[model samples]
Target chain A: MTVGNTTTQRSADATATGAAVEIDQVAVRFRTKKKDVTALRDVSVRIEPGEFVAIVGASGCGKSTLLKLVSGLLRPSSGQVRLHGEDVRGPRRDIGYVFQRAALLDWRTARRNILLQAEMRGMPRAQARQRVDELIAMTGLTGFEDAYPNELSGGMQQRVALCRALLHRPPVLLMDEPFGALDALTREQMNVELRRIWRETGTTVLLVTHSIAEAVYLANRVIVMTPRPGTVAEVIDVDLPVERDYGQTMSAPEFARATGRIRDLLGATTTAE
Target chain B: MAAQSTIEQPERTAPAGATASATRRPGGAGAGLLRFARNTWRPAAVLAAILVVWWLVTAADLVKPYLVPSPGTTLDVVLAQPGYFAHHTWITTYETVLGFAIAIVVGVLSAVVMVYSPTVEKSLYPLLLFAQVIPKIAIAPLFIVWLGFGLSPKVVVAVLMAFFPIVISTVTGMKSIDPEMLQLSATMGAGPAQTFRKIRFPAALPHLFAGLKVAATMAVTGAVVGEFVGANEGLGYVILQANGNLDTPTLFAGLIIMSLLGVLLFVVVELLEYLVLPWQASRRTDATTTTL
Candidate 1:
């Protein structure tokens, strides 16, 4: 874990970018009415600047919990989560999050939804408007800026959610299966769009997903976790080309091999448990 | 294969033919207007039928005239002795508006406090429930005794009658937000106050409006009941006076006016809801278009 941290920091510094996040021996437990359930145990991961890392696990593997811990929405029962080497006792403004559901306020238009995050951060209206315009154009939402969430398709609403997450230009983006609710074809298209956006913005992204192909295709490295009292099972370096086209990459040998290995790891863990 | 071909052919041809036929209808705007009228005309016709039935029932003396007077006689009473009920109606309207405004302010403030402090909610919620459960009419006389008969007693009665729904509704609205949304806001480093203002408040608006609509209708009834208890002015006082004299037409006239006021207030609330939630309207319109 120490070696991993140094490598992460060295690489982060070498790239002239600061260490974005560090999670040191983090553990989370939930006390229900009946019993205490351990969600994550002895999980340590360091996400370097500009790295796209995907955390992949089956249900009950605490993947979402890990995302929450890093985003500072939940504190680890033990260990520490740090942003830029500073302890994250609570949520930080430098990290943006997108949920599986769009979760757009039904009453607000797409433009207003984007403005919400900006407003919460106390950005002036003039600055917010400029950021909103850039995001709308970047997300291809120029024509539908005034449309409400209910007026949009599931895919479009998710795009709006993505734009909202990007509005503040956070150094780290935490996404928990943002495309999970979308249809298969739309989800695939969203994956392609997300990769494009991530590359363009050079933002470090920590995404949690159940799809092995999705994790393998998007991440520079995929962290696999064990189920129930989840710990990092293995961290596999994805050797596929960084710049990817969805259709072409899926058929590439490297992509298939990476996906197959992650799938086998997941299967082995599931069967063992 | 042959049957499948026949089935598939019509499936393709029917939609194409239908589209062609629809486009061939040159007066599309007129047809659209005709469709609109056809839809609206049914409800209008039903209302007319209801009015006719009501007039006939009253005209034929199917029910006691004292209970259900003829529409003409009620109208005549309204026109000739309009001043008789006017003062009372104005008084009731004033009480309703004033009490309703106070209820809104107090209810919203309480809701904010309750949401911010569980202790406040825990302590006050049961008391509110107990107050709500009490028969407001039974307390009307007590209010008159305590506050006197000028306007204070009546307004207090109106407030008591209409306060519960607003508070309960506002509290529920303030608390009922998506957990994920709260999480999102929290992760964005938003504090409690920011969370409430930016996320929870806007999200709870539909629920708040729902409570307001119910409260508005109740306000009218509250004012009338308050007037009935002990007041020299207001529609309720006039109705009570008419009843004492056995002037059935005048009583019916007052009742009709009160009913109209209630309907008018409800419509105003609905109109406000429509204005405040235009996004809801657009969504509804979208749903209709998609269904069509």
Candidate 2:
């Protein structure tokens, strides 16, 4: 990926491409009219290029808040967030965000909705159209491009949302519980599809989800988190084979051990909190 | 509208009311026509039943003829004075249409401003509520006194009556957009103006059309009410003149024509909505027929 904003002096990392995302001692505190709430504290992660990282936590663990920090949608109370060695001062056009809800514009057809990113960024029309077609084929949304959001099933709607997010070919993709609303079966299918898509695109991904199975199934490493002043409790690495088949990956002992470790860590964190 | 705003779901923005009240797509040309027929049969049957009841009440002399004219007598009176009735109908129609047009422009503009600025909304919303509660008919004569017996007074009344629903619905639509969408827009580097144009305005349309349908009927009520206060012409004037003459048939005819005007305007607005918002779920229909 051609990193924009070349002005930021490149960080020294000879073995790998400089970190795609760097969160340095991050913290977020929401001050409402009443009490003050520390949503996250001392949270830091350095994500390398093309890495898939999942953050699994309880609802109040501020995992979604972490994703927002990376996307420049939320500013940390103290520490810094950087993308491609440049500080994230505002919403970065170089990143993509997928919300828990599909959030598709109902007035636009699926193709047009995907093309919304292009419209906002003022990308060249022909280039954008070709990219849209490629994404449609990639996402298996080929036959449903002209369909409206309400006509599509929930899974299909989220697929359309995924297509929209990937249209610009952002170097880093941030997903905040994207499949949280889908049924178990569809969620499984989407997880398989997402893994394949990530493999094909090689985009760095930061996914925040509440589903433990989903977290272990899709990420290189899962960051288990604790609530009540949200903090990272543990990071469990999955050592399954690269070509992870859905059934095979689930049956792998490494998957079992990693998932078990995560569950125990979460159980301890809940009581400790 | 306030109560509905608290219960805001994406579904809340769906064009709501009548099967005809609104929502999604249906199939091809022939099928759409067929669906239209199927939908209208119930309302047609209701109209037929009402006509039958009216005839029964008149023929049985349940009330004095001067008080409640026979449906036949009312129809005859209309048929008798095609020119006179048509002239009055045209005047009222023009007034209602003009008022509705002005209300839509003003209401939408104000709604945009109010949605963008909390200060404007804060200052104006209570005044809007107070104006609505005061009753247009009560102050309609004041419009006549200020604006005179010309069409402007009646048009002004129609505008006043139709304005609130449009403003309320537009505001709701503007606010109903998912916060995630705005975040998405920001990520794409869309400025505030582009966001409003490409997102907020289009999002507001379905609700705006709903408000338009409501306002369409209200505008007619307003015009007639304004005419009631002071006018030398229009259907409201015709009704008053017929009542004084004790010509119950003429009075009944005027009432029928007046309501027809309202329904006609409503249907026009509905048809416009259907054309403009084919994307709305209310209008969606799948193709069940065999296609080549």
Candidate 3:
């Protein structure tokens, strides 16, 4: 199965520029007793240095699978996944991931949770402490640094997750619906906070989400996907002004147009399949 | 749209007022402490009342002294022959403590190994199950026979009794991590060792402690059982001696002392839990308030 040429070329370009992540015609399939389920069909994507890109799709569209490919958590059945021009055979240290759930260690305080990443990365304790302080401040979790995951609100816990993810300053951040578990209000607030944090840190981010509005609000470009055995259906550029305020920018005509195009693509894909 | 507007408007207004109030009460220290006390006092009161009832029931002669000796008589026996019980009590305490330490070390190590290797888990887990199913008392005499009636047998019994719970709890705790957490750690370029130490171990601690608490109590019982089977010293041995002489009051005293020792050990474990996991307490508070 020849994966798309565009994805391969993009990956080649990414390799040249030392792009954070490059997925070149990557295909992933799972074998069960009864059947082989192809999760991604020659899907290819490239994330540039310091770009915020969102992958949006319906359920079973292999959005998470795409993320796993990029994170090197899963190998492509055929084709290549590259990071900094090197084929990513396993998890790369230069990428940070956040999940749908906060997934903080219950026994650890927020500060400890953030430090855990540093400890694993073998970052010196003294350096970790300074970084942790900066992260706590950036996340607006100064007072709750010593609070446990169970003690914080869903939004707060996610903030801790973000801090932990960013602690090591990995060049690429892979977020799989990191705010999906929060309530609508909390999710919106998290989106704003996330955008602000991303701008300040200047880390390239690949966010997977089901919400079109969210994809539009946070990403420079939104890659829409089809149903199971997923392939990229469309890649829409978001032309809205950067440095957004949630209240002022969310209602802009450009924002609505981008969301509309994504929604239309999703609707078409769902009906076609 | 109206609902969204209403929600947004309240949130904006509320944050300003809330921040002002929060700053004014910086850290919420006094109020937080008061709430903490308020929540804890009820449980404390109930426990005190239970103790009082036991005292009153024993004093009222509601049951025969042989069956349920008066608290006063039990106390007198304890005070009168402090040395008599103290020496034996120390023996049991030593055995219990030693066995418990061995169990913790072995349990944690085995759990870590099991998590890392499926082969080890497959082979050793069945053996653990087999060991746990056997009645500890039934093996106490065998331990005495094998170890030759010294402190070794008692300690062996205690270790055997305490080991299973810690292993099971630790294993369960280690395996119970959320997939997302692992993914997050992996994406952050953390290696296997880093993932486990930072994520799995800390996440599993509460469960591990739960098992440890149960094992602590079991360790004491194992020591006592060991003394009962064959031992020159310990509260259990004293009970056997008092039984032979028909000194019901003294036997009751020994039982009371044993109970006290168990309670004290359990309290020490609880204290350690609190010290190790201070964040848990605040989390519990947050849960209560949010639910309300």
Residue A195 of model 1 has an lDDT of 86
Residue lDDT tens for model 1, B168-194: 888898778889998888767788889
**Model 3 chain B weakest lDDT span, ten residues long:** B1-10
A1-273, model 2: which lDDT tens digit per residue?
323221222342322338888877788999999999999997767777888889998788899889888888889999888899888988999988899999999888788999999999999999999999999778766556666676677777888899999999999999999998988887888899899999999999999988888998899878888875887777777777778999988888998998889888888887875
Could you give the C-alpha RMSD of every candidate to the true structure, in order shown? 7.9, 7.7, 6.1
Query: Which has the higher DockQ value, candidate number 1 or candidate number 3?
Result: 3
How do the residues B1-292 of candidate 2 rate in per-residue lDDT, one tens digit apiece? Answer: 0011211122221111112112223323344345545666898899999999999999999999999999999999989889999999999999999999999999999999999999999999999999988888899889878988999999999999999999999999999999999999999999999999999999999899999999999999999999999999999999999989999999999999998899889878866765566655233433323231
The CA lDDT of each predicted structure is 0.79, 0.84, 0.80
Q: Which candidate wins on TM-score? A: 2
On the 0 to 100 scale, the lDDT of residue A197 in model 1 is 88
Model 2: CA > 4 A from native:
A1-17, B1-34, B281-292
Q: Give the per-residue lDDT of model 1 (tens digit) for A1-273.
A: 012432331222232225577777788999999999999998877877888999998898899999888888789999878887778887777888999998999887778898889888888899889988988777666556666576566877887899889998999999999988877877877788788889999999999998898898898888999998999888878887776878889899998888988898999999996
Which of the numbered candidates is closest to the native, going by highest DockQ? Answer: 2
lDDT tens readout by residue for model 3, A1-273: 112232333433444545567787778889999999998886777767788899999899899998888878888899888876788888777778888888888766678888878877778999999999988778777666655565467777888888988988878898999888877876887888788999999998999998888999999888998888898888887887777888877889999899999999999988886
TM for every model, in the order presented, reads 0.88, 0.89, 0.86
Which consecutive 10 residues in model 2 chain B have the weakest lDDT in total?
B1-10
Tens digit of per-residue lDDT, candidate 3, span B63-97: 87677766677778878988888888898899999
Q: Identify the runs in model 1 with alpha carbons over 4 angstroms from their true place.
A: A1-17, B1-48, B61-67, B284-292
Error of 2 at A13 (Å): 13
